[model samples]
Target: MADAVALRQALAAFLGDTQYRKFVARGMYRGRMAYWQEQEWTRFTTAHPEFAVDLNELAAALLVCHLHGDELKPDTAEVFHGCMDLARWYVEARSRLFPYAAQDVISTEGRPFEGDRIGVLFCPACRVARAGWRRR
Candidate 1:
């Protein structure tokens, strides 16, 4: 098994990668109008096989996060939970092969809101992952 710390770092790197960012941005924009080309997904999967599952989950989570904001509606909670589960798995696995990193620092910027057990409602990891997905 890969080291949890390394896996987290690698995930962070992948989330920060410029090409990955562009791919995700494109997916988010174009994805709404039509399905992504099989070739595009194939190219991405070929380039980052280790992240195939993660990317798929992230894409789903991003759509949910975008449509619903921090509020995880019942219909979208499954996707959100899936991303969180994947994050937990990666953290536990400690994989260490993160080759992609953003040329510039990736920021996790957002406004704060008040709520009971806000952390549970709007997880930091979820927010950062969403930001990475939305980043251009």
Candidate 2:
């Protein structure tokens, strides 16, 4: 319902500083500087109940951004094994991080294709939280 940034900040608060920093330290994010508060995040997610059901990729990006400071992109991100297949498409054929379909379609990460919802395919081989130039 809200924008990507909103989802990310709320996720950061929900995750907490230490855990949130992990994604950032790993170069999972692109570049960014922002602020957040757990209390506000609590309120937002609560109001948006669907958010409670799913939030893996966004959470990952939030952590990377807050810790690193930049937008969310692959080049700025730390590479992972076999991730190039997914990343090289550069955001699903460069069509945006999550693109929706007109009709009903199945998706992963607990986020069903419900009304303008976006989906992503994480490294199927590995969760690879530490995406840091593994493919040098």
- TM-score leader: 2
In the range 1-136, model 1's lDDT, one tens digit per residue, is: 3333343335335555553334433444434412443455555447666645444454454432221223232211111111123365444322221111111222223334333121212333454554564463
Q: lDDT of model 2 at residue 59?
A: 51
Cα lDDT for residue 135, candidate 2: 38
Q: After superposition, which runs of candidate 2 have C-alpha atoms over 4 Å from their true positions?
A: 23-66, 74-136
The per-model lDDT (C-alpha) reads 0.36, 0.40
Candidate 1 wrong stretches, greater than 4 Å: 1-17, 29-40, 54-56, 61-136
Model 2: weakest 10-residue lDDT segment is 97-106
Residue 53 error, candidate 1, Å: 3.2
How good is model 1 by TM-score? 0.25
For model 1 the local lDDT of residue 127 reads 46
